[model samples]
Target: MSALDGLLLERVRGLWETVSGVPVTFPPPGSPAAIVTAPGSGLCPPAWVGIVSLGRSALVTAPDAAVARTLRQALSSVPDDALTCPDTVRSVLPVAEVLGPATLAYVTEGTFRPVPDEGDVEHLSVDDPAVSAFLEAAGPTDAEESGLAEVTSPVFVLRTRSGPPLLAAAGYRRWPCRTAHLCVLTAPERRGQGLARRVASAAVAHALTAGLLPQWRARPAASRRVARALGFREVGSQLSVRPELAHRPTGVTEGT
Candidate 1:
């Protein structure tokens, strides 16, 4: 399936490596890492205890006694903002979404395709000016900035081609062995237009063309509406948390 680009996914994998003092060893061939979000289980390797919190998680690739000792020490010495020790992770539970074969389709009407934003708006790809405007609107947070890269991030935006270009930003994580998780943004004034939906389609289309699946992971009700319009049916939801906002986990990570 189509997943995050080469660069953006490194940012995610790198976060765990940097904070946990362990290597993120991806599985080879037919069997890949399972999407681990829950407390008791996930897509973990035979010996690895894979923990994934909203903002941070501790991954121990080795499951032996020595590895367990290493993990304990790693946790103890980790800073308050460490991937597993962060305040936001403690408040939420594991993720739960309905699983199905990747079959998400596009909205059938003439409205949701990758049409340009319009005279005062332009719907361009990642390198286009419209996407640039959208990122400015998103205002990258502290951790996001730490991991941000121009070409690696799965960042996309919508820019109004009007006076003094404005934007809106959105983003998502790349699930291993699946598709490029989408993140989107747009100018506040650009709300209500189907431009967001269109931008999402464009991103998914890119993933599909690459022989990868584009998954719509987490989002709010408004954003979910866009997904519905784009032909994605809800199968399940995960317990989502924002360590960045409150320094601890607080909500359910929704999905499906």
Candidate 2:
């Protein structure tokens, strides 16, 4: 994990090798890790903000504890008048367990499972049509916000005997922790067909094959179903952090 160190830029290879067919990796190394960094594109925030793909996640650490704290401040330091996403810390830190004030732990660890049979379906592609369909079914999809870096990644699709399968999509990011962020979609007409569960199982299969983790933002209605089918446990709640304390100081005693 020291790959977040300022001096280890060259040593840190991109996670593209294990990433899903989503565009979640950093576009390219813009900052040398020795210079100022642009947001969302570089591996660092202000100075270092690592951007992992949809099916992936990232962590950045300063050279030492002091710098890490400084980096933390930069992330949580937003203006009261500034408009921002609730999740925007805008800082650099390896995403550890759930932080203070966070509703639940977003990162979950589990063994990659197996993909079920999807005869005549489940196509792998550089541009995933399946993933495209998946997002349409799953609201609040980030398929559009995907930076150019993500559009260039690989994608996969899964279908059932029914015309349009219940799920399709791509990964934007992936990491050794086995965490993946992808557009998990279910077909509009395929609800209650149990296709999503199967497709999710297939993704898990691919994950096990690649030695990675298959993570999904299950629709509220489908969350319980997907979790059970994929052998995923409710390790913790995946929360949307509140914006009120978005810029609050870190280490102020988390989980209060």
Candidate 3:
């Protein structure tokens, strides 16, 4: 198998096993060059797949063969090395072919590291006025507010020592398969001062304390850097499908 295949197999195998409650060995030890697991009902979250090799082995928890076929055709053209860059996951998917009406997104998976929290960052309850203000005035748009609303835990925000204004905030919510999904937001104007990492580290440290495996799904390089600073490891890339209309390819598809 190619290196990409091996890497993807390692990541998805564990995830598949966890969700399906089944023990499986990818490529079944020296048999064929390809192994595709038959679809099972136990798989949760409908479907999620990752492609590291064109056809060596497909890492999938697909609901049916039709979806799998479309996914395969779409990803067959992806360069093996492209999967290494998590940002390419979105562009590499054959969204129209796979789900037709649904959208597929590429997201980076990250794991948290155990660390001591910086004592200075303040913790805010879900309804704290500061959290509200931060959500309202901090980001240039309402995206940050929506994300913060999804978080199930108390928000952790870092403030400017010079005043009580928000610098950054981080929190977590339950993700598929019982993992903690972390979200971090920094004031657009105060981005470069290490505030993102500071707030994220606090949230991650809290998550670890709660006996949860913290997951960081990042797309931006800056976000990835903050994740790494909080000691989260880049595990692999994932394809996230949702209920949005996918853009159709006008004619035959182009570059990989």
Top candidate (TM-score): 3
RMSD in angstroms between candidate 1 and the native structure over all alpha carbons: 12.7
lDDT of 2 by residue, 51-84 (tens): 2211112333332334434444554443221211
What TM-score, computed on C-alpha atoms, does each candidate reach?
A: 0.42, 0.43, 0.61
Model 2, clash count?
38
Query: What is the per-residue lDDT of model 1 for residues 52-77, given as tens digits with 9 covering 90 to 100?
Result: 33222223332344433333443444
Error of 3 at 143 (Å): 2.9
Give the per-residue Cα lDDT of candidate 2 at 82: 20
Q: Which stretches of candidate 1 lie over 4 Å from their true place?
A: 1-133, 140-158, 163-174, 240-256
**lDDT-sorted candidate list, best first:** 3, 1, 2
Backbone clashes, each candidate: 43, 38, 0
Error of 3 at 217 (Å): 1.1
User: Which residue runs does candidate 2 get wrong by more than 4 Å?
Assistant: 1-115, 126-154, 159-172, 176-178, 217-221, 240-256
**lDDT of all the models against the reference?**
0.41, 0.37, 0.55
